[model samples]
Target: MHREKALDAGLHPEKIRVEADPYVPIAAARREILEGIVTQLRARGRVPRVCRYALAVGGQEPRHSLDAAAAFAVRQSWRIGVGQSYTDHHGAAESLTRPGWCLVRQQIRAGYADGVVVVTHSVVSPHIDAYKQQLNWFGAHFGFVALVVPEMQEWRP
Candidate 1:
């Protein structure tokens, strides 16, 4: 399925553009896609444009993955803007403390002309559910949040 269709399925915490690495989970595909994009752009000596869709969130491990992936991408080409996290004021007290969503929301507020490219882990931690809700809410409010999950040919219909 194409990127648009995969997103329309409404599978929360969807995985997109996964790599075949044994250590990597199928859920982390979006990060893989970002990494791949970074690698490709570097190879071509070109800078990637700002992707407003970028969202780095979820469990601590996932957040780490996002950091690593974005760092890799940024090192290659600094033109890209990566949104790291968001924090919802109305969310639970624990949710408010976590820095996951705050980083991402800051980037989103920074503005982008070419749209955003969100890179998040496949699974959502309990602490991240509120953040996740924010993502869904943002999508609902803006009407252009696209979910991209990368499935192997064996998994794809």
Candidate 2:
């Protein structure tokens, strides 16, 4: 801007410095971004605990989802307690027939888990309202729900 303005004003060459480096937009790493969110939540007392949380995996690929959630948590320096993992095999999240999902909520409600992590929103609910309701429940309990997804961070149910 300085160089541009000087040039526009027809200032002497000696009065101008080289143009500053061009701006470059660089997206943050997934771990860094997620850690920032967790830090903010902790500072605001929105996080149930510092590290302890649970996992909720629903759908046909239970193993895949579970691995994603676990790996994400580990990367974020989050911890999942023993037997804190739950899964609804080949089931629909909206159906609410997922015992695994129910157990995760139970753990949160009981204050045993600070939050729940999923591989995607579909692991929680496919419907917008349903997902919001789930988020509301977590908010009410001063807990959180995290999703493991691509770098885009644009994924939504």
lDDT of each: 0.38, 0.59
lDDT of 2 by residue, 1-157 (tens): 7667867668664565564321111113223444555677668866323222223334244566677777877876677788887766544435255677777778877877777777655556656567667766766765677767532354433
Give the winner by lDDT.
Answer: 2
Tens-digit per-residue lDDT, 30-54, candidate 1 = 3444456546655888555543222
> Alpha carbon lDDT of residue 76, candidate 2?
68
Candidate 1 lDDT score relative to the true structure: 0.38
Residue 85, candidate 2: C-alpha displacement in angstroms: 0.7
118 in model 1: Cα distance from truth in Å? 7.3
> Candidate 1: which stretches are off by over 4 Å?
1-64, 71-79, 82-96, 112-132, 140-157
- After the best TM-score superposition of candidate 2, give how far the Cα of residue 67 lies from its true spot, in angstroms: 1.1
Show the colliding residue pairs in model 2.
none
